[model samples]
Target: MAVALQTLVAEAERYLASAKIHDYCPNGLQVEGRAQVRRIVSGVTASQALLDAAVEADADLILVHHGYFWKGENPCITGMKRRRLSTLLSHDISLLAFHLPLDVHPEVGNNVQLARLLDITVEGPLDPTDARVVGLLGSLPEPLSPRDFARRVHEALGREPLLVEGEQMIRRVGWCTGGGQGYIDQAIAAGVDLFISGEASEQTFHSARENGISFIAAGHHATERYGVQALGDYLARRFAVEHLFIDCPNPV
Candidate 1:
């Protein structure tokens, strides 16, 4: 029922191929806790609430898609950061975070999970030239109107997406989960009828309207909830350890 912390991290890195991808934050074990892990709590982000939930669950490790120490974030361990790290260290709960690797993994990636939930047949990468393409180009079984496509997204994600309608029905689509509105341009270049991402920017509307491609801003937290859970389930089955997915919903 228990596995060494090093062993768990090794298994995760091997499963995700984390070393092959370059990411803003370090992947694998970000913080050390107990040497052995029996229970794991997974979530979208490593927020204070999630840490508290993990502590309450008596989790030995916390696995997440979003972790601390980003590319541009302050390095100081103070205030919120200090408190979060303090809680983890105090409870001896290890933190294992995988960002870009989790997003692009073929089996359990966030985009793939979203595609499965939305019934999309993936065709290729949104940006074929990019070495690490996080977005996908795909198609529906049949074309749906912009309105109907938005409805499908709402039903699948359990959250109504902010829709920027285009003139044509959507057959081919491109998508990336979690703050991927920036990839709309790549999707447009790929000549997709619709593009979906977790968050929208001010210019996303204009880009959609100008380019004649529909856009959907599904909730970031909702879109990214799957990959971590998938990873957790995989770990549970592989290592014979208990896994819990704690939902600390973020509207943004």
Candidate 2:
């Protein structure tokens, strides 16, 4: 079945409330393609590899978490950017990307989907007063040692996470998918026994150590893989269009 490109974009923007969120990049449709979309390809990032794979799959539209035209990036579309945009234009594949919207969504957000995958009972947002931060606070059904929790994350994400073991057993947990290690302090202030993020900074180690809380840096790509897939599935079910999620493995 095929759906009009405009209709799909409108529904996606409305579902994610993209206009209300302030993101580093514009949300929703970034590139125009064919008038109708029959098949959708979703991925964590819209890299050249993904575009190539989508072309091979003959996708009508490409949905991704990361897209071009950032807040501070160079305006000129040259080199890698030129190639990426050219691919989309040449193939007539629309590019629809959602960044913070995808991360903060209550149902299909990266953080929420990750919690489900790891069996964490969500309590609430990591920072109650701040609406901008999408990190979450949750608890395991039972306390597990830091190493054990790391093992669980590894098993679930199929990647060995970097763990900073603390002295206490892990019961209360906090996490943000992708490059959200900056929220470690916010998680610490929330009194979580452990905090997990996709990438960690140098100060993150000191903060975790000084605060005496466990920390885990799961691979950025691994942690953020689920949300786009879930969103694609939802769109597929809603519009009766085919959806394919392609994972170009990134060790980072």
Candidate 3:
């Protein structure tokens, strides 16, 4: 089965409500390929490994959370950029990416998906006052020690998270997927007992310690692996096109 590339992109844009949310990169249809798409390959990032896997799978379109043409990236498609762009152009594989939209979406968003995997009951946005922070507030079914919570995260994500244990048990929680260390303060202000993000800055440790809040820095790739897969499944069900999620693992 196959669907028109335009139709799929339109559905994704509409479903994600991408135009309503501002992002660091352009959302939807980064590179154009075939008019009709029979298979879609989804991943956390559009790294060379993912692209090579997509090529091997003979994917018609590549869907990802990370894409090209960022807000401050150099425009010249020279080194790695040239290789990636050439791969797509040579293979005629379309590229579709969504950034912030995929993070905060009510359905199939990274935060919400991670909540399900970690058994957190989502309460609301981490910072309702700040639209810039794409974090969520949630609670565990029961209060668990910081170490126990970290173990749960490790088991779920298949990666050991860096835990900065606070002086309290963890019940109320907050998290943002992918390099969201900047939002730790916002999460603290939200009054969560613990905060989780993909990366941590040097200052994050002091903030967590001083504020008596637990902190976890799960790998960025590890935390964001679910949303794209959910989105791909949605598209597959909607359009009857084949979907594949290739996890080109990243330690960072």
lDDT of each: 0.94, 0.95, 0.94
Clashing pairs in 1: none
lDDT per residue, candidate 3, 1-252, as tens digits?
999999999999999999999788999999999999999999999988899999999999999999999998899989999999999999999999999999998889999999999999999988888788899999999999999999999999999999999988999999999899889889888889999999999999999999999999998999999999999999999999999999998999
Worst lDDT 10-window in candidate 3? 125-134
Tens digits of per-residue lDDT for model 2 on 196-247? 9999999999999999999999989999999999999999999999999999
After superposing candidate 2, which stretches have Cα over 4 Å from the reference?
none
TM-score of 1: 0.98
Tens digits of lDDT, candidate 1, 94-160: 9999999999989999999999999999987999899665999999999899999899888987888
> In model 1, what lDDT does residue 170 have?
92
Best by lDDT: 2
lDDT of 2: 0.95
Error of 3 at 4 (Å): 0.3
List candidate 3 stretches off by more than 4 Å.
Answer: none
Which candidate do you rate higher for lDDT, 1 or 2? 2
